[model samples]
Target: MNSIDKLRIVFMGTPEFAVASLDALVGAGYHVVGVVTAPDKPAGRGMKLQQSAVKKYALEKELHILQPERLKNPQFLEELQALKADLQVVVAFRMLPEVVWNMPPLGTINVHGSLLPQYRGAAPINWAVINGEKETGVTTFKLKHEIDTGNILLQERIPIGENETAGEVHDKMKDVGANLLVKTVNALANRTIEEIPQSAASIEEVTFIKHAPKIFTETCRIDWNKKVSEVHNLIRGLSPYPSAFTTLDGKTMKIFSSEKEIAVPTSEPGAYETDRKTYLKFACPDGYIYVKELQLEGKKRMGVDDFLRGYKFN
Candidate 1:
């Protein structure tokens, strides 16, 4: 098929992570027939319904959009069918019904945040950083019966820097995945692509097959018994999101940035060290984590210096 005569595409995604790929597709001249995002729901203190990032971008691009409360709803399915899309592209979206994913002639291709066969789940970016993997990447694959268990189309590896947070890696992956999406689309247009089964190799051989399950309050609590490096990774992995937290002076404190201190420590694990004049550091199994950025319970985010001026650590 000619580049201009390429198959129509239906995009499904909900968050900002997926926005880059969606924008890239439109900019690359692909015919995005429609977009499917989550329904707007009440958020924040005012409790106003907020549209998804994908929905907002789709509106600006003037593309048709669908925000079905349930994927199995008949009206939503009918509207989706009306688009007559030849292919579907999924990014950071929820699981789809078989009827929906199987509707497109070319099948649904998902832009997974992690390089497939690893970190396969709802929060790939966070898990990669938490697991201390030196490198991570994005993958384009055909959606199949199982979640993220698809035939691989293309993957581009990106290295994780030392002391890097998951948020940083996330931004980089967004750009890399966007470019990879354009490449995959062009290849599909020319029929030069091959889909490789993910099961061809044993799972044991996959070095970094970590799960990126959804984050919760309990999961974000700092485990001081763990090695300092592990605890450090945990803090950065969840930074600026469902952040890693601990209790201080009977109040919850979220830690956004920290530095590992290798010096010998006498304090027990979970004990904190601070001077009214300068800094706050928590003792872990191996060393100390000097918290440089944090937010105390019921307080706004602030630098260590600012936090020290008003709050005294015990």
Candidate 2:
């Protein structure tokens, strides 16, 4: 057998974003010995236990699964050690302790959403869109103690469409990251790829590095007082989850999609201009943000026209 065939891999991740990478590894005929994911947690209106996307896929594949409530638990550590993995691949999983990440002889692999040294944090894709960046990419690197500041193994650039939402970028990135991860693993198994320090990778640019911290509720509030571009980017950055919202008639209305009109608004920022039949837009300093899709308080998400059709003006 070849090197890759003999290499035992332990896959670790939780969300749907991580599923693609695991699937790609399995599809590539790698020997995945174990899958470590988050424990099933109560969720939804029914409050039933919900399995992570990675766990579900692992179950379907009949792979050995482990859901540890705490990474440092002795029982979990012993069980993990028993897997005898040559390499551990992590994507969208919780932070790992030294014992866990340092367990495998070949070391741990991480598939991060953004290029290392840029947008490295809990929410890379969201911050990239929010910053109105034109391009971003995936980076596969070794897992180190210092969060995402690991040595780079492989890199792939992905362009961000001007109006793309974080969710859309996420969808694109998962697939790209999956493919790159497979390539990274195969090269590593063959001992063909070299690890480059993040410093070397950024020396060519040496630009001001941008970070992507976790997004909170305050980050999701739409500030129409800002310039139109900033407000629109904020809306796009948070779309499809914990969406950018503003007060409309003393009630909260979440905007899922919007179009920016670059015209001076007659009304002050945060003021709404709706036809009461079709369009609904909010004024910003330099333009208007036309709401294409929205969810008003106590209402289901719908097109703006549909929302306008059923609502009465106060």
Candidate 3:
């Protein structure tokens, strides 16, 4: 047997974004002993129990699965300890207590969505795009007491395309992160990795680091008073999830994709102009945000032309 085959691994994650890493490890001939994911919960109009994407993939792989309602449950802990995992890998999972994260001999490692010392939080991809950053990447780090504050194991940086939505960036990062996680695991098994402290960089160097807190309903409300570029970024950053919104005709309108018009606007910020056939746009402080994709309340997502075809502004 290969040396890597002797190192038992346990994976913890809950979403589609994490399936890539778990799949990569199994494909690479790693001995992933078990998987822990969120419990199936009711979803959709019919309220059927929906399994998490990671759990679905794990079930297909025939891997041992655990879905504990509470992380601190004694039964779950007993089962986890029974796995005898040499190391643990986490991606898109909830916070772990010390007993769990510290149980593995080689320690638990996390594949985070952003580079260290910046964009540290639950919604890194959304925040990076919303803040108009030119670049962001993935980081694999050892788990510690503080969230996302651990010794760095490996990282791979990627450029964020202009006008790209957070959903787009998320899709790209998942693959990159999967490859990097495999590399990190191989290096760890070979004892070739050197852990570096985040504080190794001076405070002056990382002063611009930003936090990526969880986005809320209030957070997605569009602020037309801002510059067109800023408003555009906000819309794309939240696209397809907690999407940026505004009220039109006293009903909510969700904006998905938009183009910016930088010419000085004739109308006040928050004011909208529509030709009732071709375009629907809102003015900002500096210019206009020409919304190409949007959804009106009680309607399906459609292009501006299609939206205009069915309804006329009073």
| Candidate achieving the largest TM-score | 3
lDDT for model 2 comes to 0.93
> What is candidate 2's TM-score against the reference?
0.97
Ranking by lDDT: 3, 2, 1
| Cα TM-score per model | 0.96, 0.97, 0.98
User: For model 2, how does the per-residue alpha-carbon lDDT over 211-261 read when each residue is reduced to its tens digit?
Assistant: 999889999998888998998899899989879999889999999999999
The order of the candidates by TM-score, greatest first, is 3, 2, 1
- Candidate 1 ranges beyond 4 A from true positions: 206-208
Q: How well is each residue in 1-314 modelled by candidate 1, as lDDT tens digits?
A: 43645679999999999999999999988899999999999999999999999999999999999999999999999999999988899988889989999998788999988877888898898988988889999999999888999899999999998699999999999999999988988887788999888877575856546778888889899999888889989999998898999999989999999889876778999998888668889898778999989999889999999999998555
Q: Taking the tens digit of each residue's C-alpha lDDT, what string does model 3 give over 236-268? A: 999989899999989999999999999889999
Query: Given candidate 1, what's the lDDT at residue 194?
Result: 94
State the lDDT at 253 in candidate 3: 98
RMSD values, in order shown? 1.5, 1.3, 1.1
Residue 300 displacement (Å), model 1: 0.4
lDDT of 1: 0.90
State residue 197's C-alpha deviation in candidate 3, in Å.
0.7
List per-prediction Cα lDDT, in the order shown.
0.90, 0.93, 0.94
